[model samples]
Structure formats: C-alpha cells, structure tokens
Target: MKFQLDQPQGGNSISRHDGQHVWVNGRQHGASLLVPWRGEVQDWALARFDDLSEAHFEQILALKPELVIFGSGAKLRFARPALYRALIAARIGLETMDLGAACRTYNVLASEGRSVLAALLIEAA
Candidate 1:
C-alpha cells in the first residue's frame, strides 16, 4: 500500500494512496499508513501534534472526513469535549486512540472506503 500526496491546498494537503505507505510531496511520512487502492478513495486528513488538545482543529474541519481519529502518541486519553463538540457540529465521527492503533485503524478504514482523518503524535518506542 502506497500513499500519494496531491499538492497541498495552502499548508494543508490531501494524500491519496497508490499502494504502500503514505507520502507527502513524494516524501514518506511515518506518521501515516496507506493501504492499497481498494475501490473508492477514502478522504483523510493527518496532522502531528505534541499535545492533542492544542492541535489545530481547523485543519481537520477543512478535510471534512466522516471520522476523526486522534492519535495521542504512545499514551491514550479521551479527547477534550470542545474538540468532540466541534467534530459533532461538523457531523464527523471522532475516535481517540494510541498512535499505533490509530494508524492501523486509519489503514483499515481507508481500505474499506471510509473517510477518515488522523491527528498523530509520534513517540520514541
């Protein structure tokens, strides 16, 4: 499974998969995982953050994915209510999980043709 990145819309970007891992402007991004071209291209937004609460919500909003997965690095926690509410207002589903879990979930959802966005914080393993 490869991921191909379309030219960014401003600082934000949309990456489509060709086969393997996800790429941003031809550079591989470890923060994201891309599955093979299944059928319909699933839309996704990915952002890296040090603190999930401080992440820029506008980016996710711009993508307008059906589901939002918050990757809280190696540690997992509930997302702030404000963030959840914002997604709810946009009619997006929100899932908060560890980064690894989120990555796996993103790949599975993408393969299944479900729209998903991921905010991942990388931690030293």
Candidate 2:
C-alpha cells in the first residue's frame, strides 16, 4: 500500500510496503534493510525470521536509535529476547510487528521527528 503525508523536510519515511517490497522516499527496496529517521539506509543481512541472530540485533547498535521497529516479515512473530539482549542492555526500546504495520508505524514516528529505526525483513516469495 502507498502512504501519503506531508513529507518531513529531510527525514526518511516509508512510502509503501507490500510484504515483498518496501518503498522508502519513493525508492524501491527488495531486501531486508535498516531505515533510520535521517541517515544512510543500511542493508540488513537477514533473509528470513529463522535466520535472525544476536549479530543481527547487534549490528543495529551502531545506529543508536532511541527505538527500533522490527518488521518480522509477512507475519507478526516475536523474537527470542536472548537474541536482542544487547539492545535491551542498552535501554533501546524494540517493537515487533508484521512488515506492513512496521512500515506504517515507522512513518508516523519519523514524521513526528522521533529517533526511530525500522529493521524490516523482506522474505522470499
């Protein structure tokens, strides 16, 4: 689905998401990636929920977002806390949802100028 809003001056906002792909600032991305409010969009190496590991969560630490919106592919699946212990230890909040919800939530928070990061996974068809 495509989203409409008064785009933030320079921050990143999700334009559309449809399970298999996500459009950020009008650009299409087909792989898992990390989208921050205002910064470089990083490629996340995960391809499936089952491949999630501590290293995955650890990689996000470098971005230092106040909150993380984790998109667990096409469905809402919770990850083991142990996998994201590093984030917890750092006091960074993490929220999990299906990809669509994550994209919508990220857009709202980003537009409000919140320090949010979206860790979205795009699973294979």
Candidate 3:
C-alpha cells in the first residue's frame, strides 16, 4: 500500500509497503531493513523471522533508538523476550506488529520526531 503523509522536515518516513518491499523517502527497498527516523536506511541481515537472535536485537541496540517497531513480516508475531533482553536493560521500548501496521506506526511516530526504529522483516516472496 502507498501512504501520503506530510513528512516531518529532514526525517525519513515510510512512503509505501507491501509483502515484498517497502519504500522509504520514495526509494524502494526489496529486502528486510532498519528504518530510523533519520539517517540512512540499513539492510537488516534478517531474512526470516525464525532466524532472529539476540545478536539482531543487539545490532538494533547499537543504533540507540528510544523505541523499536518490529515488523514480523506478513503476520503479527512476538519475539522471545530473552532475545531482546539487552534492549530492555537499556530501557528501550519494543513493539511487535505485522509489516503493514509497523510501516504506518513508524511513520506516525517518526513524524512526531520520536526516536523510533522500524525493524522490518521482509521475507522472500
């Protein structure tokens, strides 16, 4: 689906998303990725939800976002809390949702200037 929102100045916002891809700031990305409110969008090495590990969350922790919106591909699934223990220890909030919802929610929070990261898992189509 495509989104039309008044983007916050100088910030990145999700412009579109579907099962196989997402568009950030008008650029299309075909793989799983990390979308921070600002800064370059990063290709997350996660190819499937079942492959998630603490190391993945640790990578996100390094980015230091106040909150993370984890998109579990086309379905709403929660990760093992133990996998993200480091994030909890650091006082960062984590929310899980299906891909589409994550994209929308990330845009809303990002537009509000919140330090949010969208850790989306875009599985192969």
lDDT of 2 by residue, 35-60 (tens): 99998888999998999999999999
The digit string of per-residue lDDT tens for model 1 on 1-125 reads 75753332222232432223444334555443322222222223333333444235655666677887766656686767775566778787878887667656676676556666665544333
lDDT preference between candidates 2 and 3, better one = 3
Q: Where does the lowest 10-residue lDDT sum fall in candidate 1?
A: 34-43
Error of 2 at 65 (Å): 0.3
Per-residue lDDT, model 3, residue 55, is: 92
Higher-TM-score candidate among 1 and 2? 2
- Native-referenced Cα lDDT, model 3: 0.94
Residue 102 local lDDT, model 1: 69
Q: Provide the overall lDDT of each model, using Cα atoms, as 2-decimal numbers.
A: 0.53, 0.94, 0.94
**Which parts of model 3 have CA positions greater than 4 angstroms off?**
1-5
RMSD per candidate (Å) reads: 8.6, 3.0, 3.2
TM-score of each: 0.58, 0.94, 0.94
Query: Residue by residue across 1-125, what tens digits does model 3's lDDT show?
Result: 76765888889989899789999989999999999888989989999999999999999999999999999999999999999999999999999999999999999999889999999999997
Count of steric clashes across candidates, in order? 4, 0, 0
In angstroms, the error of model 1 at 46 is: 11
